[model samples]
Target: MFHPQQEQGQPSCRQNTEETDTDSDESEYNKAPDAPLTPHNMQTMLRKATTDIKSHLASELDKRLSGIKEDIESLTSRTNHMEARIKELTTSSQAHSQDSTYLHAKIEAMEESLEDLNNRSQRNNIQIRGLPEAVTMEGLHNVLKGLFKSILPEASAQDLLLYRAHRALRPQGHNGPPAFLRN
Candidate 1:
């Protein structure tokens, strides 16, 4: 059938051109469109595309690596700062512990001094129980110096420091007629 290629006096590459004359002008015209795109040209274009893609990928990888490196360095710096803070905290803790130990020792010493002071105040005190409660406080006081001196003949009136004395309660349920005395 008469088609557009037939009207142009050209053979279509889709037909069996090999069965016809291989030296026809239409056959040469059919191959003209692919003449400039040789294997060498295609290979050179593929090489350039490969080189460009590789260079672009390399640049992208470099950017990612730099970002990761910066992140690692920042993390390391933060870790170092945390470690220093921990060290400072450890030192502060030790200082607080030492302060606590010192305070504990000082408190113990103060307690001991307070106990000694209490003992010293009571050193001159005397309590005489089972004395006759029938006597008045003046009567008890009058005989107290002589009674204390009788116990220690080595003591004089100056050494016999007798303080005021008074009566105390008897046993709670006791019906005994005599109450207790203190001097």
Candidate 2:
């Protein structure tokens, strides 16, 4: 079959002619005008372009590094603040524990003192039993006066006897004779 370009009378070697034309055009354009090309000027322009690109890259890197450094410093400051707060809380907790221990000791001492007072009060309270049916207030007074003389010598025999009779008659659940009858 006859190709379209061949039928239209176009060159069969058109691709080769186009390549040659492009090469020749580029070579003509690269030829220096009146001034001869110098290695020094080419080197200077290359150095300037490289320096500008490097400077821009360096500035961008410096900005990123500065932002990172600020973030690191912020993190460090926050860590320091947290450590200080932890120390303060630890100290406060220790002080509170010490205070609680001291309060506990004081409460224990107070309880012991109250227990002693209660024991002494119980000792002072007398409970007399197995008395004869004919036991008189006078006889009871004589006996208590002799017994309590060492602790409460200032108290009268009659008062001691009356208090004892009242307590004996009202012993817990048993309500004994009236006040006048006991007397």
For every candidate in turn, the CA RMSD to the true structure comes to: 12.1, 13.4
Worst 10 residues of 2 by lDDT: 1-10
Give the count of colliding residue pairs in each prediction: 0, 0
TM-score of each: 0.50, 0.44
lDDT of 2 by residue, 1-183 (tens): 122344455444344334445435334435544444343224334545787899999999999999999999999999999999999999999999999999999999999999999999788676655444454666866544655664587877555564454326633335454343353
- Give me the candidate number with maximum TM-score: 1
Q: Which residues of candidate 1, in runs, are more than 4 Å off?
A: 1-42, 127-183
TM-score of 1: 0.50
Backbone clash pairs in model 2 (N, Cα, C under 3 Å; residues 3+ apart or in different chains), count? 0
| Alpha carbon RMSD to native, model 2 | 13.4
Error of 2 at 176 (Å): 14
Q: Per-residue lDDT tens digits of candidate 1, residues 1-183?
A: 222334366545335434444345334445574656533334444555787899999999999999999999999999999999999999999999999999999999999999999999888778766566565777977666766776788997777766666666665333433332233
